[model samples]
Target: MRDMHESSADFSDSCIKEEVLKEKLLRPARDIRSILRWGYPKFSTIRFVADHFQLSLEERHILARVIMPPDRIISRINKKIDCSEIKDRKILIDGYNVLLTVDSLLKKELMWFCDDGYIRDTRYYFSKAKQAEDIEEALDAVLGFLSEASPKSVFFLFDAQISRSGELAGFTRRKLKEYKISGEAKTSKIADFELKTEGGNPESNVIVATSDGIIIDSVKEVLDIPACLMEKMGIEPIRLY
Candidate 1:
């Protein structure tokens, strides 16, 4: 599974500088995609293509994440469920993953509409020092959606190692109750691992809300809350499909 950290690149000036770069690298992106379809090692294949194209580090990072093999792309799309399908189903939230991406979108940061039908932020910009107030609006949008979706139940899990995670969990719990949504928020050292394990459980009628490729691939059903938020905000991500 690819690390969740790798899904990001760097953003600047409140806009993604890579938009123009993406058009220039289209041919290289296609060539890299073709080689990736052959089951070649993703890292090495991308490095070779980047050197051949003389692409910069930022451009290379974008390709490493946004480009997926044909089969994997189809698998991801097939696993995705529409918002209408979210009714009365259990939702396991990847707390920070969803929060950060939506936060990025809210801030007008550079994000991607990847081929796999997921919206992803290119920059990693959160930390233990990140205050709850910083993501207040982002959190509202997320919890607001859940209230509207009317899921059977929701569980929000945060990474305990992150600074103030417990506080964030508490804050989320308050919002959940305020929203009158049936759910709880807690912190775990291995939140990602737990999400993956539970998501893989065939007996659980649960769909995960995350853009993490690893977790998405392991789960049978996925709800793209960020994408839904994008539609609501009338925002379009940088297209890399």
Candidate 2:
């Protein structure tokens, strides 16, 4: 029994030493000139380099600054998180704000008449197809990200004019619950109006996620709650992912 315990301890120490040596050997040769070069086009090269090397979280954070020098690293980190203390906060998302950002990424197909006398209606058809694709893709991304991040609760508000279906409602509910996130949907003529009326006290804890400047300003004025926007098309909240 004593011999077995000693051998196990030695093995553990050896494994630790091997890991430490591997990390030291893998550490990149840092250069100020190379770091400055990474700043071109705002960290595009640096991000690629970080990803290529499979950098650890701490290393990635440090390299992120090398690529794009920011006055405050803490603020940059905070922006990536839904909140520093997000476990207790309910997140209200403006559905249209998320959809529109996604839609903007899709390229619009143009209809042009041939040299001969022919008419083309390609734009109309393309628009319809793109809209459907955009909605599905955007919803998947948003729901998947939120589900994994597991905010305390997420309420998605959509305009009644869009006419969402029961299937989508059921899908979102199941997905959220599966990931231990509470999900709810509300359809109102004006989501902002509903939010303002429902938001109880000035100190009632909540975070509204929207890109609308007007809505954000109003919410802050009324409830004194902080607001954040979903990331731009093809860009997700960094640390959360």
**Candidate of highest TM-score:** 1
| Residue 238, model 2: Cα distance from true site in angstroms | 17
How many steric overlaps are in each model, in order? Answer: 1, 0
For residues 118-182, could you state the per-residue lDDT of candidate 1 as single tens digits?
88887753553566778989899998988888999999999899999888899988988899999
Query: lDDT for every model?
Result: 0.83, 0.44
Per-residue alpha-carbon lDDT of model 2 for 72-105, expressed as tens digits?
3233333223323455567777666554443332
Query: Which runs in model 2 stand beyond 4 Å of their true positions?
Result: 1-85, 103-134, 165-171, 197-201, 221-241
Measured with C-alpha atoms, the lDDT of residue 223 in candidate 2 is 13
User: What is the alpha-carbon RMSD of candidate 2 to the true structure?
Assistant: 17.4
Residue 162 lDDT (model 2): 57
- Model 1 lDDT, residue 102, Cα: 86
> lDDT of model 2 at residue 204?
53
Instruction: Superpose all Cα atoms of candidate 1 onto the true structure and report the RMSD in Å to 1 decimal.
Output: 6.2
